[model samples]
Target: MSRDTIRADLCIIGAGAAGLVTSAGAAMLNRKVVLFEAREMGGDCLNFGCVPSKAILSAAHAAHTVRAAAKLGVNAGEPKIDFAAVMDHVRKAIADIEPNDSQDRFEGLGVRVIREWAHFTAPDTVESDSVTVKAKRFVIASGTRARIPSIPGLDTLPYLTNETIWQLDALPRHLFILGAGPIGCELGQAFARLGSDVTLVEAGTALGAFEPDHVAVLREALAADGVRLIEGTGVERFSGEAGAITAHLAGGETINASHVLVAAGREPVTDTLGLEAAGIEADARGIVCDDRLRTANRRVYAAGDIAGKGALTHLAGWHGSVILRNLYFGVPTRQSSNPIPACVYTSPGLAQIGLTEAKAREQYGGKVSVTSWPFHDNDRAIAEGDTAGGVKLVLGKGGKLLGVHVAGARSDDIAALAAITMAKGGTVRDLTGPVLAYPTRGEAIKRAAGKHFEPVVFGPFAKAWAGLLSALH
Candidate 1:
């Protein structure tokens, strides 16, 4: 038997956001491009992760708002949730976004789309069932999947992961989650609001590596949503018979749920691809790429979750653009870990950019100052009845805006401003001097910065300093 060969200027593996965007850009530059994928075109984020989850979160938020009407002086009855309808909404969201990332769209971009798994057959060649792709440069945008832990008997239990959770037909009467990270917290709250009894268990304290204040806010919000959170505890054992799952805890307790959701974490999906043939180094985490998003083998590059540089879809897209610039235009661009923003899609979403307070204090020493202002005090928050959270700004020794953490309505939107400021190395004065609109959550940004003016406003030397300046004039 003889093998067939196809040649392209660039060969991209995985048709997710990173791979597809890179292909589109590269092809537009008149570089011959070939793309391979073993799964759906839009990858995990479009098909399983962000889109479906956010759709569910939106529906859950609406339901929660209706239930809270009594407290807002409007007494509405209990919401009758149709789980099927919720799933329908999720599917519709996927459908609406699918066309943008469909195979037809990529083909329209003058890139060859191959719906097959690719394996490296040589240092400069990859082989799939139908074609042998030869290219000067390659990109590994292969994404990640839910990482199910090795809890005893967990495999035997009827469980769900982000990949399959959206496919569920009926809502679980009770949902037991095994982690307290972003995914666990977001899904736990959403389902609980939809009338499911949700129990979330975390081995460490709340949302382990996050800031203490953030942990407190999330804990309080989850508690308010009628979700039972078991922190500082873990599952000792798990067993399943028929459809029910019983998880025995290390603390001599047990939790029974109609379904178990293992949102523990995610691991990169890079094993099946023949990386060793290309001499590329990777681990359980992800492909080890250099500052320029280049693999150890210079001919290959990586982007997105697979690169392990940043797990965000936006970051991945940015990395893809950087790779294109370096490979095509001969421009050198590197990845930066600073000023990246992430959000948890809860009610009054939690959005964080740059360093946390503890991190700032440790890295920059005692010269850092922290200031916070509550959303409850903001006119917009008060008017909207969502005065549950606030914003905090961390500044360096000389008023450099080190970070901004917001946990209130429109925090997600506010994060863009924070990212741009931090990336541009702006100071507190810049944010404070801007005249933000009245009755807006974004005013919290300016207000938090204004707190730095407190000493100038009422310091012990205020009168003396004013008199001295007046005399000098």
Candidate 2:
């Protein structure tokens, strides 16, 4: 069969978050656009990773709330979880948001949506089974997939990755998850809370990227949620089948579980993109790109996880804007100039941005000041009886807000307040100026900032002035 050749102003591979934004925005700019997808729309985020994980967490949160209601003098004794219903909710959540990223929607925007895997045949030409596309520019937004580690006998049995876990018809009696990073931790807690016996085995420290103190709080919360955590060790191998499985750890201990999942990490989807043919540099971390998100081939750009940047849906959209400005506005946008926030949704969620206290102190030494406030001191947390976590503020010599970490209810949202201030080059003082609403978790940010300035604001000079004013009176 003869292949149809189409030409366009822009050709985007992978109809994920980054590609969707680039396609939609370029279409609005009246540029001829062609988009390709190997699988579902909305990428792994809507179809697998973020959306479904959060939906399950939302279901688990309800179960937790019912269990905790007794503390508030309401007896919501032992909630019964309808596992199928919970999965239904997860599907509905995906379905509800599906149309926004649907192929029909992009086609409506005048984007030529190709439902085929695209590979580069030439520097400027991409071809699939039925058609070939030649465009002035190309944007690669093909995201990542769960990275499955090679362990002995792992492939001998059926296992679940983030991509396939949503098909779970019934909850695992005892779910064995490898890796305790954000995804592993979140899924472990969610399943345990929803009445599944869950165990998480990690080769490294759990949530090793976050500050030790903040990670401690999250670890404790995971334990309270009934997640059995095995850290600093790895699964030696796996044996048995889908329903009956055994995990042998490095230390010679074996765990029998009903199901196994590999949440170890994500691998960028680039093996099929024909990067070598196009001279684009890439590796295990994804495609190597500059701060402007340009690949070795100037004619091509990559965004989202595929850009070698860490996975964050918000950041992917930002990357699209950067490309737009560079391509059309000649604005010379840089992706790393602004600090990005990383958040984990594990019970009292964890959110962190910029430098950690240890990093700031190592860099600035005496120039750094650390201020922390526990949620126990915050009336809102006390009222709600969830006073497990707190907030930490890191500052530099000139009172510059270096970083902020929060582990409490709405901690991610609370970090937004500090993010805005930091993004504008504002100091901790900027965080303190606003009169945050009472009985809210966000007060923690302002409270921590106020603590950072307490001594200077109410010290001997102010006291001496107060006394001198009294004498004058």
Candidate 3:
């Protein structure tokens, strides 16, 4: 029997942020596009990852604020968390954003949407159970899933992953998390604020990617939220049934909890892609793609977590745009050419773009200049009574912006300005003298930048010049 075949200009696998953008762009350009999605429309970000996580985080933040309102002279009593209602908010967030990524929207945009898993049948073709697609170009944006570690006895005890945690009908009595990455930290704090006893165990330092000082602020915030963080150690094994589980630590101590959440990490979704059939190379990391996102099969490209470049949703979207520019507009663009910004969303959120203080010193040696402005010095933070950490600007030779790290409230919004400056290859001067509004969180960035120019602006030469002018006058 012959399979039904459809030919197109571009064929995309995955309906996540990366694939959706690529399909929309191509379809709107009057190009024939075929998109295959094995699951939901928005993939992990909308359904299981960013969207749901942030929604829960928002709820947790609200509860935390009410509890902390005594500092502002408002005695808002203890918050009573409705775990089911919180989960409802998470579901509602996904539902609201589902329409934009739905099959009807893409189909209306002239894309042939196939609701099935597709894999390479040949170098130029992909075949699913119901149909086959032949295309000029292809994209693999299937994204990723939670990586479950192989701890002894863990298999027998039921555990939760980011994908499965949302299914819980009630709050956990004691939540045991197996990782201390962003997901673990975020959820750990959220659950703790929601009155769940949360413990996070990590073999390495938690949020070690950020500066130690900034990490200290986050540690305090998480501790304040009643999250128990165990770093430099890990679970040796797990035991017990679904309702009651025990985590055996490396040093022999054990932790008993009502639930287990494995936020260890993410594994790229590349199962049964038949990459070898299409001459596309891939490994445990993800599909092997070049700086331009071109796979071993030059006709193919990758985006999102599957690209192995970055796992961020924003990075995924940027990858799609990069591919569109190269394939459609004939423009040369490299994914690495742009700067990436990352944020850990706690009370005093941590946002970083480019190198850290230690990294800058290691890379540039004697050329590194560090400038900082404490949040306590900022009028806004002082007024809010929540000055946790500050903004640190790492500068290289000629005052170039090597990095910008903000560890305070609204750090993401503040770091956004720094992200643009880094993307434009601008120096610290770009962040300086911006006429930023008085007492705003963003002013911290400007103040940090201004610190770099203080010596030059108030130098001996300037003082001499001023003296001469005064004498002449």
lDDT of each: 0.87, 0.91, 0.92
Residue range 152-171, candidate 3, lDDT tens digits: 99889879999899999999
lDDT of 2 by residue, 1-473 (tens): 77999999999998888999999999999999999997998998899988999999999999999999999999989999999999999999999999999999999999999999999988899999999999999999999988889999899988998988899999889999999999999999999999999999999899887888988888888888888898999888899887999999998999999999899988898889998888888988999999999998988999998988789988888888889989977788898867789999988889999889888888988899899899999999999999988999999977898889999788989899988888899998888899888988888888888998889889999889989999999
> Worst lDDT window (10 residues) for model 3?
430-439
lDDT of model 1, residue 422:
76
Deviation of model 1 at 309, angstroms: 1.8
- Mind giving the per-residue lDDT tens digits that candidate 1 earns over 393-466? 88897898777888877788976777777777888888877677786888888888888788887687997888
- For model 2, state the Cα shift of residue 47 in Å: 0.3
Q: How many backbone clashes does candidate 1 have?
A: 0
What would you estimate as the lDDT of candidate 3?
0.92
Instruction: In model 1, state the lDDT of residue 274.
Output: 93
